[model samples]
Target: MGTHVIKMPDIGEGIAEVELSQWHVQVGDLVVEDQVLADVMTDKAMVDIPSPVHGKVIALGGQPGEVMAVGSILISIEVEGAGNVREGSEAPPAKPAPAPVSEKPVEVAVVEPVAKPAAVPAPAPTRAAPVARQPDERPLASPAVRKRAWDAGIELRFVHGSGPAGRILHDDLDAYLAQAEQPAQNVSSRYARRTDEEQIPVIGLRRKIAQRMQDATRRAAHFSYVEEVDVTALEELRVHLNHQHGDSRGKLTLLPFLVRALVVALRDFPQINVRYDDEAQVITRHGAVHVGVAAQTDGGLMVPVLRHAESLDLWSSADEINRLAKAARSGKATREEMSGSTITLTSLGALGGIVSTPVLNLPEVAIVGVNRIVERPVVIKGQIVVRKMMNLSSSFDHRVVDGMDAAQFIQAIRGLLEQPACLFVE
Candidate 1:
């Protein structure tokens, strides 16, 4: 018999550590080679770690939500044959050999002892004693409720538990946050005076976003430009196209038209399709157009790229966009699908306002934002007309793209959108 230790392998992109999102097998569970064991999440993507050898799991290294370093011992397994035992060869003399086939399974603790709850302060003589909790007992709350409280900087302990047996519910956390946001005078009148403030730890995807935004703000000089486009003709063309091929093909969205227009504009202005090398201090231009579409998922914002978008037609572009967006929202997009974009496009659909200054996705030179389209009266050819007007809000890295080039690129898109037929003029 031999025992093998499985170490965390380098998942992708030179990532050093990953958050253990879930565990599929527990200790003492017999697993086979290539069987999935756990799901780990990095900043770029979520990856499933597979078992390397067919064996019985003896121990697990960590629990879910714990950050594990690469090359660290992930889990140990006891295999049948005395083949190559790479990690643990010096077996203890107490258990000279493996247990017989008829023996019961070993019972080892699977949960790690890393994420212990914070120590509670002693209650004052005037107040009742706090509820006793086991050392390993975790706070009883759903993952969504915990995430909401974490995002709102509310501690779970301070939140009054309304669920059965002192469980925290989503409504309880919401009510606590809503009350906390009220005026100090109102809060004092409604509840007892409190002097403590909750401190929430920033981790996971939110931490990555915060760090990247800080880097972008410090490294790049952002300049925003907003222009209103008359999309009445474009909308008419879109509706006609959807009606003609909506059943056979995918439903056409404004994004494909916008993407086509951007491709044309990029051909005219190649400077926007460039990436910056801060260390080398150079801008590298690419011939291929890999456009990224910013998608808001339950986890956070994810940008899934549409590779070689310049070669795809309106229908193909719309199909790929829908597929990528759905994958991102469902947390199923691969790393390749989420990376390697030269520029990005973000839209809020019907929720888009009149104007918004979007932040530049780092290393990329520009980002395009789509605003809500509203119909209003306007003058066209010296005649009163009711037109659908939408605003295009774009931000550029001032260090790379000049103001004139930015204005001209957006103008090119505006012209194409206004004359809808020009978008198909190869």
Candidate 2:
């Protein structure tokens, strides 16, 4: 009989491969069309792959937690009526009884790992109670919810669900926390005994973010130079412009203005807008500017690019940046918008950081870091007065961009911000 092979399908853009995070089917199991076969983690997000045809699984191509490329064979299936067959191999031997067409296919149960035997045996009286829900009778839940429960150290069996088919929701986490109660001590006593130390396991998105940052730092040659800029006039102009425009729905943020300033700065310092050719030992400068705004998502760090950023007006830039950032945060950014960035801009003001040295996006020569603009008392005209100020830090690849060029590029940006009128000049 004929056998069918299922190959992995495209899950995302520019992502040729993904890590198989979970496998739902195994050898000798019956699967149907649209049934989830596995979950794969792409660069942007995690997606569940479904079976394309009905069949009994024969073998899997890769193990869970292993990365596999797109279009690679994922599983081999034995089609109904057409038994398992191999190329140039002998036919299957006849069974003792003919296989019934109407009879349900028997599933070959997967053997789970057996833990080591306990040191002591339990009492016979308490040994037997009642069997819990069988696998088929149990309610269905999304793999993400199950993973969250597992990570929170909560038993799935004990949690109540509020989703379709009785699936668990994130709100159920509160009940889990309530079930996990503390006892046997007063708060004062517990606090007295508590040492000023805590241990947290790094897992999920935070863990992945940490790993990627470590990788970026380890692989790229990063050189950062910080310059403090007086943005008092810029901030005042922004406020006045916003009031005059009166676009309540689309209030201008410091970012779009910053992006506009950067575009102008790059017009003069194009080297800062180029990508480094690590292999060819050359820097390829782009005629157009595609600026990526680094956004923090629930999954991890995602940088969404605005194509032809230099050609857009300040309002259009603000609108698109707003849309792209929103999309990235919602995990709906398209692949094209997530890739092909010649440079990037990172902001940590919402989190309240004064200054930071951001790591370079590989293949890209530089990244600009935006910090908080606060009112700090300073000596202006030999008198102490509250003035709005911010620090801008630009990190560049020393292999491609010289220190003088980097410094001047950053200074040009500062000059534009301080002048506020040069950004609009021809």
Candidate 3:
């Protein structure tokens, strides 16, 4: 018998180490090639590590939650039989066949049927044996689709693939779900609900976000200021812009204009763009503006920073934001896209909240909250008129920014929005 060591393989990008989540085999247990031996978790996804050869497991390096680097030895296995040293490759030795049973005559039948001088039969011609069946090979779906199937408790293998080359697609899953007449698959039991709630351990991206949010809250003395702005004129400009240049020109969302207005305001008041150095008791006032747009994702919250926002025009800023948001939603966002944000903006326009107190993005002095815009009655030149109004609420680190400074910053943005011509000024 010979021993073979198994090492961890690279599973995801920017992942230096992984948490050993689970082990499926134990010592002395025989495992086969391609059998899943353990589950490892990186920052992005959980991947199963399979055995490459047939062998009996001899030792485990560590338990679950223990961080292991890539290429680190995970398990040791002992190969069986001579020259079958390839771990987890050879089939387990077959058990010995049971011995044959014998029967005899009831009465004294005597003599073993008189030793018939038996003639040896001619040797039978030999034939070759049939080959063993090979393992199944089907086209795999995208990892995102696979994850969705797992979340919905659906088996991808059983689903009829209708995608290219018989590969499973998201639409295929949707079609199956639409036509399925099986009993309702309840995600959780209503009657079995416990009075005591079970706590789910937050790991991966969610954990990282939680840590940063907590630090932001604890370190910054936040004060929120809210004001309602009449965006009818801005909306009119957007509609005109869209009419001139169709959707192909760009998705003329109000965010770009808002970002532009913020940029202009920051140029005038650079102190508001500063990050507080809590330990050094100093503030880093950046000359160049980098704005982080918080995008909600299936995995958790991800903020993709728009670098050098001060230098980019409104159209360019809109295009970059659109591309980054798409990437974030598709789980294709990179580490660089997520870090080095000097400021952040979060919009709950869809949820329709009138006002909200946005927590400061740590070390950074501010976060801007955009609330839903709806029609409201306002007196215009002594005549009550219906207009689209939205609340712009900004939370700032009070230690660095006073209430007057915060109000002035919002006022400057309001001025730019009120007079859209100001955005064109250098």
Highest TM-score model number: 1
Q: Give the clash total for candidate 2.
A: 0
Higher-ranked by lDDT: 1 or 2? 1
Question: Could you tell me which 10 consecutive residues in candidate 3 have the lowest summed lDDT?
Answer: 125-134
lDDT of each: 0.84, 0.77, 0.78
Q: What are the models' TM-scores?
A: 0.72, 0.65, 0.60
TM-score of 2: 0.65
Number of backbone collisions per candidate, in order? 0, 0, 7
Q: Order the candidates by lDDT, highest first.
A: 1, 3, 2
Evaluated at residue 81, the lDDT of candidate 2 is: 60
Candidate 1 lDDT: 0.84
For candidate 2, the per-residue lDDT at 381 reads 91
Q: Which ten residues in a row are the worst by lDDT in model 1?
A: 91-100
- lDDT string for model 2 (1-426, tens) is 467777778775567977776679777789999999877666645566788778887777777656778887777777766443566774433112223366677788999999998787343231222234566676456788778777877777776665555566666655557546645354346545654788865544455467677877876778999988888999888888789884654678898888888899998998788887777878889989999898887666888898898889878898999899898787567667877899899998667477798998877888999988888898989999888888997798888889999999999999999999999998
The sequence of per-residue lDDT tens digits that candidate 3 reaches over residues 108-226 is 65566567788975653332332232257644689999888889888776676665556677877876676575444443365454577788767545665677789888888989999
